[model samples]
Target chain A: MSKVRERTRSPEGDLPAPTPDAKQWVVYTQKREGAPFKWAGTVEAVDTELALQYAREHYGLDEACVGLITYEHGDSVDGEYSIGPLVPQKADGTDGDEWLVFTLAKRGGNHQTAGTVNAPDAATAINRGTAAFADGKACNIRVVLASDVHETTDEEMVIWRTHDMTYKLAKGYSKQVRSKWTRIRDNPAYEQYQKEDIETHF
Target chain B: MQNMLADQLANIVLMHADDKLMLGHIQSDWTGLAPILEEDIAASAMAQDDLSHALVLYEFLGERFKLDPDAIAFDRDPCDYRCCDLVTIPDEFDWATSVVKRWLTATFSQLGLHRLATMTEGDLGDRAKRLLDEQTIQVTHLNRWMTRLGRGSIESHDRMQAALDRLSSSAGMMFEPPDATLTEDESFCCGRDELFTEWAKGIGITLDAAGLSATITLPDRSTGGGRRGEHAPHFIDQHAELTEVRHSDPATSW
Candidate 1:
């Protein structure tokens, strides 16, 4: 049987759903040479403008003499966001312990995948990344930790170049990697048998 | 600085200082509770700056009256406070109200602080001006969000409008006349600068058109005097929170 994805049927079906309750994000603005702007608190919106607009109403407007903006990953990457793993939820309602940090330098530098973080939030992760960057002496870099990131397992696998055989290379790197979103089987441990098969290639 | 004009000027200056102190007090409530972690931390820094500016003015005022610092700060009642009515309203948990309110306060504060900074008096006058320069940084911070939301999505536009509606009316009191002490000096004091007028011209809207969601009316004098030792009972709790250790065993230093 030929397989067809659901979104292939409808264009409007492509939009991501709204973030659920208690999973909302609040925005803060670091104004240029100004008091940190504490705009209104709002839930994570679908679009950056939506988030920023909510943020602006919440934090700016009454004050004058500046442009309004919130600098976050969603504002930049179109759909590359959320391509990896869905952010896991913490029982405490704050972000999870695990984190993935990225550092971008050299005037719109590519966010060098510095590594992942197991820290609490983006700020702390950035602090660590900044120290690392400063030590390495890489000047003029923007540090952004992949906020709200986590996973069920670090050593997971993605199906290697074929759909017929259950042969997945360990650690998710493959000749043809998935994009947008992918379902790796209900149980990631199922890939264990394939892990044994990959040792031969090594 | 000795003229009634100067004295009135002093009252005006006091009003500005008092407003910062009071606004700072209210804003600090959000230090740990802001919606986002980054925002909460950022807001906390701003709160500290506001309080620091207040301290600068309070120190000057303390020297004038020979009163202890806390007495000028926590001891004063609400009616005694020279803060504009805009700051006294309960903090709406919503960020819209907080930002809009802060935005309004910062704009006026920038002008007021600058005026004080340039005053002829060398002592507090010069000091207040320096504080004002620092405060301008905050104005820049809040203004960025204003433009974003003002030109943002429809939902954001409505929310901004609603915040304006809710917070605008209280703004009138920001410019109300000071108690007799403020009127004592004129040369170095505050003038009824068309702040509202300038604000409208700079931003391009009357308070009504700005989309504030609430109306503020100055309360009758019965619950008056946050500056001269009259205050809400809630202030008692605040004093307790801030001064518990300091007041407890004053002989024991931390």
Candidate 2:
């Protein structure tokens, strides 16, 4: 709803709007369990926490996703500053930062964290990673620094225990109730007959 | 005794279904009109979830009450529907108010569903358990939006505070049951007092985390007529809109 407010001039006679501290985060979505994280889209937020909320609502809601992870675009370094395969480089034994490299095994499929690479920065890691682990169709690549990942403790994981309810599982309804028509006639081939009749009519 | 309990159970379920249907309709109103494209799509998805939940409950009620689900949902008069006033309040295009309302209603529903999932009596328990996953998703989304808006820009923060203050009066009525008898039923899992305590604690935690604890006062039992099927003024219009298509051609089939 719109609210009408009296115009009041500031001492500075209307200072320009301050720029937002929000950072652009690249979002990846795992559509289901065991699926790879695909580059879904981007969101602007102040931190990973808020970025997650935006990412979940924006990229995660449109599909049946199991999880979403986001990384700041600014976190990337060097070559082209985009998510993709990189040119190969000679191995220099410098013992650099550990970066987790993810790649799509096929075109328009899940982007899995295929392997890790030790390199000076994220760009080199992607380059080395793609050269090392890239299959024929490694269409997209993403690299995250190891330090960004958070681990959950056993105690904190307890909140996820939802009273052992199995109703959410489809298999929970595997046992079917006997149809009321069974009392009228015990026909083992009832389903087959119904299927044939429907097919014939159509 | 058994019949009375069954009737009470039906009433409780009916209230939930009605609340969901109304909330779902209100949320769908913002489908194309939300401030942002992402939020617009998200709200629409959540609205679909709410409607799906309502349909499930309506189907269950239809079986128990021996009526068609469509008739139960659309053909009833205003007094026959048992939704609370909190969900029935019009948002008047205020994004902040809608966010607050969605958050409060989702939290209340989540707690209620959790308790119902533990019920040992009937299939409602199983249904409640099944619905928990979707309910949790909606609650998390709404909760995040609530926090974001509450602590966002100065104007947004002010709007949120005002919405919370205005809506808090009837917020307590969410925990109110249709009758005193249902509370005592062990299968229902919780009484009004217990549910209220859990709800208050949960809400306090959420608000505190969002940094709005000191700014807004949580309203307790003040205005409540929803339990007896008395609705807020806006509910009639909502009911009309929801039933418009269904009423237009009662004899037609899609």
Candidate 3:
């Protein structure tokens, strides 16, 4: 019955000029202090500040995350996906800027923070990172300049709230919703309804 | 005296809860329809945050009043609700208007919650403090969008400006006292005039950065608005749409 919903407008003229898309930034989340950060997702933002904000709102709030980091998508260099674990190479060096290293455990698994390497450039950083972190256990290695990775500071670690956040999680509503349903229906019927609800809704 | 203070606190809490509920409902409608995929997810997540914040406030009131939180949220008559008209105004799904409206409200909410956090009255202060932590994310995102779109292309800049001009008057009305009796009590909410000054100052800095200008002045207290329960027609329809499911089965849990 909303007036805006009922109202219809005709096209006035040609469409406006299209604006260029924002840069993509890959996000990673650390579940707790001292935990290795794992790949979470990506967000599009114009700059590092906005990217970190977007990452916090999207990935950080999606679960119980203590910290998160983001880097420009283009800034990362990914090693080839191997059928098995990658063998540690002899590409060792410690000459230049720091590069944060992340490693994949398997083909489809998420990349997690392993360690760091010091190299002159991205290519050398990846080489040195593979040499240091890929110890026959990781299937792939990824490296990005430490300067490009934006992390949540100690003060900003309240990504997960102290208040009751059960309202957004599915399990938060399960108990109350089930008890309410049981008031009118029998246990069997409630179970069937729960099944359909999960399939259709959740 | 304690009872009166509690009543005023409840009124302020209701105003904030209702504002967030309506804002979340409207913003959620744009989930699949936003301008871009990333923005769509970001806006939707913030909408969920708003809804969760509303539930938290409603639960606070529920414990104090011995009423169910869901009933407090959905079963209220239109006049009993205390959200500002700025929140209920239709954005027509326009991104510029949506972003502008959120910026204006988020700025006010940040200031309002800051006042609540200063209060030593029970868990209200603690709850507000917790909510303020999350409010930073919304304000930062909207402020950046305001600046980015305002300084973007000519079309975007014009759209943002037009949206700001359209919503400025209602934005000022957000400072109106939900209860006229509380107007004289500076301690009730740190004084409406003072709150407006802080709000306008915060808003001005962002507006200046965005290169967008609009004169936002506080409205007269005598002129009643949504806070006083005199809602516009759009709110009536929105309220119906929001409670349609609950209305069908008031006793059933949703």
Candidate 4:
């Protein structure tokens, strides 16, 4: 038989609907003052207050530390966008690594591009830094590799990998402490590489 | 100084802390699950705050009584629990009812603490005063949610009010005394003989009158003595769930 016999599952298999009882949401916890937000554990709730309450009880208690909880929401914009629908825009299934580039600016100045982030695709790369944006500006933008601007090599953009983001985060208390900040001031280079290697969408 | 007061304080603290522990777990179920992102975060934060509050009381009780906090917290059967009937009722997956319960409970507790703050003596008095300070924060947060839902949408108001009517009879349960194994002589807990009546008459009356009425039917606690280890089916179910994990390896670290 021709290739018409070939079959594949739909992308819908990857994303299941939220259950009526288990309301799942990403919780961003502020563990410390100046650190960038690291991914915290997920929790269930019926609504916003209930979700926050759940996060506080599960993550905030037992440890005599201060923390804040927020239902990690998805968003979109110019330089910023939600990490969803990881649509790999390739023809022949040849994909490599794409890095997310961020340039943190202060007072309207040219934000010296922070660093390149590893991503499977351009859109995926852009999402790793979206939650940091506040107003109309990309709180952080792209700095593709050694080149400090929004440059992307054809090889880097088309490359794909299954490198999950989970391995990079710490296991326990350290991860708990890492979830507080809005941005990364240190180790910009490493963060840049990470943006390209993984897919992070809410 | 008096042993009776000490026992009373222990009982009071145990009840308060136990309620917080359970509610804290229940409240945490909402994390990342709320209808709105903003409200989700805010509510989660309060859950952490409540747990923190419980920890303080638990620690105090543990230290004063020379007992392990976890023992008192996880080891007790629901029948042995002294928490009022108000906190025992299941939220039944209803968010509005949960909020109303918290609002009403906090109001009643705040009143209890308020009266305690005026005590001319005793460490319990001092602790109550301190708790009162923190309790206000919870009171404000809960009250805000209630008013928001109460005044904003007609549907919201109706949902909350209906839940209130269904659970209205349990409000008085908060003031009722259990048949607690704790006695004035045992250094367990005290003052419940008339504390519920006094608290209702003194503070509850004002709160009920001040636009917070939903109708509270005080449980006839005299019929069943929970404080003395006589619990109903609801409590047994609760204890089974809460203790299942803890008893798995009681002597080991969780």
Q: lDDT of all the models against the reference?
A: 0.51, 0.68, 0.84, 0.53
Which regions in candidate 4 have their CA more than 4 angstroms from the true location? Answer: A1-202, B1-6, B115-127, B179-213, B217-230
- Candidate 2: CAPRI quality band: incorrect
Candidate 1 per-residue C-alpha lDDT over A1-202 given as tens digits, one digit per residue, 9 for 90 to 100: 1111111222244543433432344443333434332223343544453444344434432232133334443322211123232222221223445444444333333333344444465445444544443244333223333443221111111101111122223334343345212445434665775687788676
Instruction: Tell me the TM-score of model 4.
Output: 0.51
lDDT, candidate 2, A140-190, per-residue tens: 566778667322222212112123323333454332223334543566577
Q: Write the per-residue lDDT of candidate 4 for residues A1-202, one digit (tens) a residue.
A: 2121122223444543443554575544434444333335666655565455555445544332234434423221125332332222232322445342443443343333233445556555555434332223434453232221111122212111111123223565456456533244356776776776565531
The number of the candidate with the highest lDDT is 3
Please give the lDDT score at residue A76 for candidate 2.
43
Considering DockQ, which of the candidate structures 1 and 2 is the better prediction for this target?
2
Ranking under DockQ, best-scoring first? 3, 2, 4, 1
lDDT tens readout by residue for model 3, B1-254: 22322487788888888999999988888876678777788898889889988988888888887778898888888988899999999998788999999999998888888888887766888888889978877888899999998888888889999999999989988988888877545323667888888888898999999989988888888879998789999899999999988899998844
Quote the positional error of residue A71 for candidate 4 in Å.
Answer: 20
After aligning candidate 1 to the native by TM-score, how far in Å is the CA of A139 from where it should be?
14
Residue-wise C-alpha lDDT for candidate 2, range B132-222, written one tens digit per residue: 7778777776777777777777766788888888888778777666654554453135566677677778878778767675232333333
Considering only N, C-alpha and C atoms within 3 Å, which residue pairs clash in candidate 3? none
Lowest lDDT 10-residue stretch of candidate 1 chain B = B1-10
Q: Which ten-residue region of model 2 chain A has the weakest summed lDDT?
A: A1-10
The TM-scores, one per candidate, come to 0.50, 0.74, 0.88, 0.51
Query: 2 or 3: which has the higher TM-score?
Result: 3
